[model samples]
Target: MSEALNRNYRLCEEIGRGRFGVVYRCYSLATGDSFAVKSVDKSLIADDSVDRQCLYNEAKVMQLISPNPNVVQIYDVYEDDSHLHIVIELCNNSDLFHQIANQVFSEAEAAAVLAPLMAAIAHCHRRGVAHRDVKPDNILFDEWGRLKLADFGSAECFREGEMMSGVVGTPYYVAPEVVAGREYSEKVDVWSAGVILYIMLAGIPPFYGDTAAEIFEAVLRANLRFPSRIFHSVSPAVKDLLRRMLCKDVSRRFSAEQVLRHPWMTTT
Candidate 1:
């Protein structure tokens, strides 16, 4: 519309859409570089204004973690009376979910995705930001094939040893303590990452069911298993890393920094 084009960025075509709004290919008039822009109407968001507050929190958290290439680049935030425009790095390949949905992810390929993300997660945690959500759909790859972490709407700033209580992540990846409604920390993100890695290798979520409630039940019990038929090809060290990251005990979960230096991350 006129609102978008008049903002000095030319909107090309709609590339994708999510709970927030539509994403489009946009080019900056001043720099001539192209980027992706997400446009969301203020009225079409969530109840209790949680969605709007999440939008603001996402911006604040991203601004705090700027200049990290492993994370999505948020160029600017613009708002009109009707909509909020978030200009961000465009990823032609979209998200990792579709790619993994169609094929198996070899150990190296999984590592390729996890290493930088571990680093990015480390960066977020070091800055006291818990991403809270770390699903495959939020992992994007640029045109050059560099993986970047996206979607921080569920993110929250945390202090060390602080316990946060909230059921706030994709069901399949939610940490056990979170499902149990117990106090939790940034370790929740590691559990989500562990679930992602499991899916990448097993071609299915570790905790899955016919309904969301069943899945939540499985998560509450920390029911995790590597079916021999599925994980038959996986190496022990990689499985060991998964066990550590997916630990039911939040205190035992591997931190992002520990995951980054994990042997499987460095091995072929």
Candidate 2:
């Protein structure tokens, strides 16, 4: 498979890295198109089958959810004795995580970035997919400035009324229910989005600490706050929408569809 891939794609440079491996920007000699190729090291995995299946499952999930404009497309995948290579859409503008870290974002700016993501997430939910990890890094943009939701490694599809139990997600963005180790549903994704929204508007997470444990503790307390130092200029209407989305009460947490129609997202 590795030998065949070279005929189709010429690896240009290392573009980025993911939890699994390093990503390279590749070009198709046949089509003159650019693509991202993630090369996961096979030697790192003691159980090769598990790694293979995990990657295969992620690819399948992306195929099921994609052809929609806002989701990353998995173009092709192949494996060599040394590495497993997955071809994906190349997002030239980097990701939302770096954007949040490097700049200050206004409410309108944040809402504009979030509107497409919420719509994409809603589309995933409608198809029974739970993108359990909805952090800033997973959101990326192409050269055309269209943002797409990337990374389905932590995503899963669940049936109606099904409950999932596992402590999964980035520590800072994880919902309280996941930390509590309770049976949870797709709504946990909404909670993650709330955390992302908070960071987008405030330039920092609502719950934060120097360590992962401290942050987890802050999440468990589930206290939402707006410090005047950061949010003084933020509007009441924006905060109102944030409150609903960030509602620690799972029952009150806004769904992605509900979030789309929220006053903050809809208004000029």
The candidate maximizing lDDT is: 1
Question: lDDT for every model?
Answer: 0.87, 0.86
RMSD of 2: 1.8
User: Candidate 1, clashing residue pairs?
Assistant: none
> What is the TM-score of each predicted model, taking all chains together?
0.94, 0.93
The residue pairs that clash in candidate 2, if any, are none
What digit string (tens of lDDT, one per residue) describes model 1 on residues 94-139? 6888888898899998888888888889999999999999998899
lDDT per residue for candidate 2 within 52-159, as digits (tens), equals 566667777887887788988888888788888888899978799889998888887888888888888999999888988899889999999898998887788889
Model 2, position 76, has a per-residue lDDT of 83
